[model samples]
Target: MKSKGPPGGGLVYSTESGRMCPGCRQPVAACVCARQPARPAGDGVARVSRTTAGRGGKVVTLVRGLPLDDAALAALGKQLRTACGSGGTVRDGSIEIQGDHLERVMAWLQAQGHAVRRVGG
Candidate 1:
């Protein structure tokens, strides 16, 4: 078997320190670099759709393929949720708004200059 990191250049576990982060060579608990980068790049085009699968009897509006990164996506989700006066969240780089707000969400995204498309009827 071979070591995952560079030879003799990875984390060192000792009584002095509990754990370490190989990325920043810092303590694991306080390693800022270990956190994933927020607002990662994405593909172009944004699509809106409605689905009720696996969610009991509730319908959720799904918005996907937005070019914006995570921070922007979260902000946009917040705005859309507020606009719809409903609860929603961002999951797996997609915005999931509660209830069927496809028309409302499409209009809002189009107003925001997004190349929006209505998907899944």
Candidate 2:
């Protein structure tokens, strides 16, 4: 059953474009509608915490509230991962480093002259 809205309502794929963005109706590679939102403003401090809520009880350190742009944040996340000798990713303006590296992250951030705060128990 389909309602009478309009013909060719949406284009999901194409031979030329390969894939189309629903929001912009442009090719996936050339789409400008799926831009990432700006990071939330913070108090100029980086908060680090360790949690195991998800990931099958595997501990992961989260660094939040860092006042940095996307590129800089990614670079910092990479450095943090290297410093902790583990793997991780940066997403939604936060850094998620695999394993529990609360102290190491805090120390590194402090050494880099960024105010660090330990969050959670």
lDDT of 2 by residue, 63-105 (tens): 9998888899999999999999999999888999999999999
- Which candidate number has the best lDDT? 2
Q: How many backbone clashes does candidate 1 have?
A: 1
The top-ranked prediction according to TM-score is 2
lDDT of 2 at 57: 96
TM-score of each: 0.69, 0.73
Alpha-carbon deviation at 82 in model 2, angstroms: 0.8
Write the residue-wise lDDT of candidate 1 on 25-107 in tens digits: 77778889967766545567788999999999899999998877778889999999999999999998899999999999999
In order, the Cα lDDT scores of the candidates are 0.87, 0.90
Report RMSD (Å) for each prediction in the order shown. Answer: 7.4, 6.1
